[model samples]
Target: MSAAGPILEVEAIQAFYGTIQALKGVTLQVNQGEIVTLIGANGAGKSTTLRTINGLMHPKAGKIRFEGQDITTTPPHQIVAMGISQSPEGRKLFPRMSVTENLEMGAFQRKDKENFKDDTERVFEYFPRLYERRTQKAGTMSGGEQQMCAIGRALMARPKLLMLDEPSMGLAPVFIEKIFEIVVQINKDGTPVLLVEQNALMALDVANRGYVLETGRVALEGPAAELKVNDRVRKTYLGEG
Candidate 1:
């Protein structure tokens, strides 16, 4: 790990959407080279926490840091420039844009061509399907293919940390498995990930550590293996009694 500390740190954050409170003092961390997952039921504030961290929604309270630098009040665009890139819940790609164009947009804040080329190559390496469809409009692709393009676009940012929200949503079982496998490979290749997913089984499988959220609070947290076997977690999130 860098002497700078965790790749991301969230301390007791509270968030609100209009009058509705979303995140209630949630705290978490993603250390260098680790995949940390946030798993919870619907309305448990999983996505809210990610939104708060990414600056799409600012926390009403608490602090956020990236690489030990305070970013609690950073603007969303600046936050992206600061090396935190997020592939949001909906694969919000530019529908009219080709796969390569979408990936290029990911590097909009970047000015270096050589590194951009390298990053695009790395993304294609991870998702060869993107390479095959490089010229196809993103909106015309299958859900799985679009998901890969979304992630590939995020990778083009060459983020110091990647935050993926619900990557497996709407995907077929086969695609889900493939996406999770690639997630592990990406983590292994050196980008720390903070994943917010409802697929607790798959999320925990790839995660190094996890936090379970309930009603906007952290209900449980531990190493992934421990959380996997926890009675409550198994019953609530893992579909077992």
Candidate 2:
């Protein structure tokens, strides 16, 4: 983790899905260059938390501060401009578009278009497969390849904080390992990440700190190392006795 202060702070935020609440007073923080993960089971509101932070869902109450500014109700595009980018749960790539085109969309908001090639090269360096399939349609690619493109797209944004939702979901074990390795490399290259994942063991392995959410509320919070060895965490999330 970098010495810089918290880049994002979610304070007791409550979010609802048309009156059926999804996030119950959730609070968490991601400091500069730190890999902070939110781990939970299905329907645990982990995705909701990320959506709220990204301004896709407005909080019913509480505040979200990014880089020390209040943005609880900011528009999603505006939030993206503020250096927060999300590679959402489904990868959400443009199925008909070529890999290069999909990457171009990620940098659509940048005024510095001249450096787009350089940025794309950097992403290719992270996932050589993307380079190999630069002209292929995104939807036609294998799952692992698509996943790499999704992450590569997010990197094109050059965000200060990257929020990933279930990045390792549905990939083979080898691809899962590869995805995590890229995550580590991304962090080492100076971008902080707020990861949401169902794979608790893998998330904890790469995260500097983690929060466990159960049924729309935070159930446990601690350093990643501590959580990995925690009796309750080990027994419940890790499937360890």
RMSD, one per candidate, in order: 1.6, 0.8
Query: Per-residue lDDT for 15-77 in model 2, tens only?
Result: 999979999999999999799999988999999999999999999999999999999999999
Q: Indicate the TM-score of model 2.
A: 0.98
Model 1, CA-based lDDT? 0.91
Model 1 residue 7 lDDT score: 80
* lDDT string, candidate 1, 69-101, tens digits: 999989999999889999989899999999999
Query: How big is the positional error of residue 12 in model 2, measured in Å on the Cα after superposition?
Result: 0.3
Q: Pick the candidate with the highest TM-score.
A: 2
Instruction: State every prediction's TM-score relative to the real structure.
Output: 0.97, 0.98
Computed on alpha carbons, the lDDT of every model, listed in order, comes to: 0.91, 0.94
lDDT top scorer:
2
Runs of candidate 1 with Cα error greater than 4 angstroms are 1-4
lDDT of 2 at 101: 100
- Candidate 2 positional error at 149, Å: 0.4
Worst 10 residues of 2 by lDDT: 1-10
